[model samples]
Target: MVTTQERVGAEPDFALNPSGQFGVYVHVPFCASRCGYCDFNTYTPGELGGATPAGWLEALRSELALASQRLPGPTVDTVFVGGGTPSMLGGDGLAEVLDAVRSEFTLAPDAEVTTEANPESTSPGFFTRLRTAGYTRVSLGMQSVAPTVLRLLDRVHSPGRALDAAREAQDAGFEHVNLDLIYGSPGESDDDLHRSVDAAIGAGVDHLSAYALVVEDGTALARRVRRGEVAAPDEDVLARRYELLDTWLADAGFTWYEVSNWSKPGGECRHNLGYWNGGQWWGAGPGAHGFVGATRWWNVKHPNTYAALAEKRELPIADFEVLAPRDRHVEDVLLQIRLRSGLPTSLLDADEQARAESAVAAGLLVHDGHNLVLTDRGRLLADGVVRDLLAD
Candidate 1:
């Protein structure tokens, strides 16, 4: 058994879990091109200087080996390969990533292995290769079907590519395929949003995740908004879009498992659920964040730095924070309350329970015996509801 100090030689004390449920998150921070709204730590070929996938794979293997030793006993239940366009690695490259993971950590009998793919970069052959390589799920970014919206977001795929990719994944034996949609882009209209969702539903994917376009600072969208070249998504418009999405998805037999995600039965993304439902997981690769026990840590944002640290046989942890009791309670109320299972009211203090009562009376929440669940109206204000529950 490797001691905690053995996890990251130069870093502060880490690796807080020895047993229990855990997952693995692998980040591939390489994209074909930068998306306007993306602020994630990704580098295109031009930005990479001289970094190569071969070099990155070695670093990833090193990290996973350390993680396996650091958190022994319990096997990983899920593996999520997220990206800077993971599909950019092609089928063989992604297969190498999973091979590295398997060689290091022991996985559960039915581990759900998933990878996020870009529509333009994926194909029937790509999906089939992934299935053959043991990937059980595929998530493709299908932000919008509108050409103008795609251009505005700097997406490279054509309007029909996402729909094509989704169908190919299903045909390639992916039962848990997910398509992501982004609503409320400045140039997008209601018809565009409707058409996009309808097309996604028609594509036979089992899961859909829709999010309002957010203009984060340092992103191209933020710069455009600051220059008055584009308008920020209106709050009222976003709410209306959310309502429309819920109604449409519900009518199509999909259920909202979380505020931003909907899916057919048993089609939910388990790796994401791990993040929301207080499960421990190791996050490898550049800019990935991980949580195990009460402690959370993130890797260095630059891929080069991450790889260099791995070269020294060290975990590329940039910083870590051990959550306090109050912090844990606040996070629990904030996250679990948004889920379908709801938060146990027993976890709330007297003041929070009283606040929950007020929310229930206001129809923002409902009491399912011991749990406090968000009503449809409440999900529209999920953040507010969580705040009210935690308010002093």
Candidate 2:
């Protein structure tokens, strides 16, 4: 169990908004093996010692029970199961997870439930079970279709596995399937990306998310880059790849809703939109972060430690921070400006408003009614535009 000292300052210092969206994020820390480039909080089988999915589920149920008490009962609008590799839990394990959620809180009539799966670890039966259990969407990590790129990234899935899995999810009655791609990896050619995107689109999935690969610190990829065994991602090449993917998705009738995500009409991920739009959510599980009322809290990261705390009927909370007004505004501008719908001008101060006008003149932003939307050129430099707008 966590020490009293760890929970001393964990109490939320803020309050909830009492209005807007509410969701839950359940983190699964178990993976068959860790990825070379992932910095997310997850544990591989060897690293987990004697920890198993059964034990983890018991702890999860406890955390959710305790969380319901504090958050009081609100109808949950979304539930996202993310992890080391959720599919590693197999079909029964995933269904048990949803049942655990239902045991504690009431899910909305049309709650958007989702799970992220590894392509190699899934099957038609697995998707079928999840669909039967009320899961509305599946996100597969397709990273890329090139064998060389897969090896460099330490991804184990066959080039075609993600597509097959996506098709399986559709056949299992899931209308929304999302394929995640990591572009600009070392050794990835333009043709390699074309084949990947073509296959993903042809698989009849509705959603696509592509992100530029970053060599994060403390990861194996970072170490390789440090040792010069792996070349750092080139900014210019990444920009080119992103433009190509964007063009291809647009041609296929997919529209960009957020910078890294595209989907056919009405396929945007509601759970993630809850995040980008500042909706409240309970982050249950080891290393999960949640926001509700006014405070944002994250649980202890290690699975063993988290389980210990939950077994004791403790919150497993590591710490929390209350968002001040400025914190909210800065986050509002930072997140809302990245969306296709645009950010309202009223959220900005006079000086920031002046910067927005300057940005519009510079072709980095355009005024859409009272909202400030990024221009096509502006998206390439999205972060820089935010900095210019928020610069003191």
lDDT of 2 by residue, 1-392 (tens): 33446676456642556788898899999887778999999898788877788888999999999887776688999999999788888989989999999999999999999999999889999999999889999999999889999999999889999999999999999999999999999889999999999999999999999999999999999999999998999999999998999999999999999999999998999999988888999999989999987778888888888888888888888887777888888998999999998999999999999999999999999988999999878888999999999999
Q: What local lDDT does model 1 show for residue 150?
A: 96
Residues 1-392, candidate 1: write the lDDT tens digits.
22334445544445556664589999999998999999998999999878888899999999988887776456889999998989989999999999999898888889999999999899899999999998999999999999999999999999999999988998999999999999999978899999999999999988999999999999988999999999999999999999998999999999988889999999988988887788888899989998888888888877888889999888888877778889988998888988887889999999999999999999999988789889999998999999888888
Model 1 residue-pair collision total: 0
- TM-score per model over all chains: 0.96, 0.97
Q: What lDDT score is found at residue 145 in candidate 2?
A: 89
lDDT of each: 0.89, 0.91
Question: How accurate locally is residue 224 in candidate 2, as Cα lDDT from 0 to 100?
Answer: 95
